[model samples]
Target: MKKILMSACFLGQKVRYDGQDSLLEHPLIQQWKEEGHIVPFCPEVAGGLPTPRHPAEITTRHPVMVVNLIGEDVTPQFLQGAELAVEKAKEVGACCALLKSRSPSCGNRETYNGNFDGTLVPGSGVTAAELQRHGIPVFNERELDQLVEFMTMQEADVA
Candidate 1:
């Protein structure tokens, strides 16, 4: 059986920066859970950052560039968390990740801007980038349908 990495918040965990949960209760996630494919995780929590911590954003020219906009430097902690996430994925035999978009730690393709102006931009979160680097396909919450399709195709191929 194949496994998938999931954002803890999306799974109803209160690990968001504001100490709240995203709680995206969707049929697709429920289906995946029934199929035993979820491996929930929160990279920020794994990195030792407490809930309700300062929300940081990428401040570099691109997502690939490592720079923090809220403070001096948090790149190392992010990287460490990313590594740990990847390790956990490996341990669980997960080949894909469903991340919380707009987060500095889990956003796959879009994240919040540090300007605090409620603006969004193209970017990959730290853990998302690391998972991509390791060949783990990462998707945002809205992309659950595509993920389900992809997983179905993979299952078909295997069978």
Candidate 2:
């Protein structure tokens, strides 16, 4: 069976920056769980960041660089965690990742602006970028259908 990297919080794991789990309950996710396709991860937490840590956003005008919103310094911890996630994906032979959106380490195509202006812009999170760079397809919660279709096609090809 093929494996898939999934956001820990989405699987009801308490690993979000806010110390709360996203706890998304979806039929597809449940099915995947039964099939043992999920490899849960939280890059921010894996990087040794505490829950309820400082909320961060991409500020370097580039999504690839993660920095402190107020201080503008690189977040080495987050980067480390993202790298860990990529490593985990590779170890598991996961071809795709399902990540939480609007997160500093898991956002796929949109993240929050650091200005607290309630603005969302196109970007990829640290972990998302690492996975993409390593040839893993990343998707947000909204893209579950697409993920299912893609995974199904890959499974068929394998068969």
Candidate 3:
């Protein structure tokens, strides 16, 4: 079975920056969990960030700078986490990724605009962008159905 690189919070793990879980309750996720196809990961925590840490956002798009609420540049941690995520994806042979939306590390298509005013902008998170650059298809939790379809196509091709 092809493994899926999934956000730890999506599987009810309290690895979010605020020490909470997003908990995706989709049937496909449940099925994959039962099938042992989920490889859970949290880029922030894996990159030496503690739980309940300060919320950060991508402040610079060109260089992918991440900064926290107090204006401390956390770009190195985010970048290290992204690199480790890509390594993990390759090590586990992940077919794709399902990440948390608006997360600095896992957001797939849109993330916070770095102003902390509840605004979203079109962009991939650090880890998500790295995964895509390494040829992994990334989907956010809202795109579970689409991910299922993509997995089905992948399976078909393999067969």
Candidate 4:
């Protein structure tokens, strides 16, 4: 079975910035759990940010930069977290990452627009982008159907 890297929150861990869990009820995730194919991780927390910490966002479209609501630049920490996540994926030989949606560290294709105004925009989070750069396909919880297709393709390639 292919190993999957996933957000810690999805696994019911209190790893979110707010120190709360975002447990997943999706069937695909449950299936993975039953099969023991999931590896849970949290980039932000792994990078040394505290629980109940300030939320951060990618503040630009180019030359990506992450910043907190208080106007503090957190790019280095985010990048470090992303790199660590990549290391975890490599260590486990993860075929993909199932990340939290709209998170600065885990969003796959859409994150907060950086205004602290609750607007969203198209862009993968630091860890998601880093994982993709390292050849791991990243998906949000909503993209389980698409992940099934990807897994099938991977299986075909292995065969």
TM agreement with the true structure for every prediction = 0.90, 0.92, 0.97, 0.93
> What's the C-alpha lDDT at position 106 in model 4?
95
TM-score for candidate 3, please give it.
0.97
lDDT of 2 by residue, 1-159 (tens): 589999999988887766789987989889989999999999988887777666777775443556664565557777898899989999999989999988878999988876657799887878898899889999889998999898998899899
Candidate 4: list runs displaced more than 4 Å. Answer: none
Model 4 residue 81 CA deviation (Å) reads: 0.7
Worst 10 residues of 3 by lDDT: 139-148
Q: Count the backbone clashes (under 3 Å) in each candidate.
A: 0, 0, 0, 0
Relative to the true structure, candidate 3 has a C-alpha RMSD (angstroms) of 0.8
Candidate 2 clash total? 0
Q: For model 3, which pairs clash?
A: none
What does candidate 1 score in Cα RMSD to the true structure?
A: 2.1
lDDT, model 1? 0.83
Better of 1 and 2 by TM-score: 2
Question: For residues 100-141, what per-residue lDDT tens digits would candidate 1 score against the true structure?
Answer: 988888999887776656799887888998899899999888
Off by over 4 Å in 3: none
Give candidate 1's total backbone clashes.
0
Clashing residue pairs, backbone N/CA/C < 3 A, model 2? none
Best candidate according to TM-score: 3
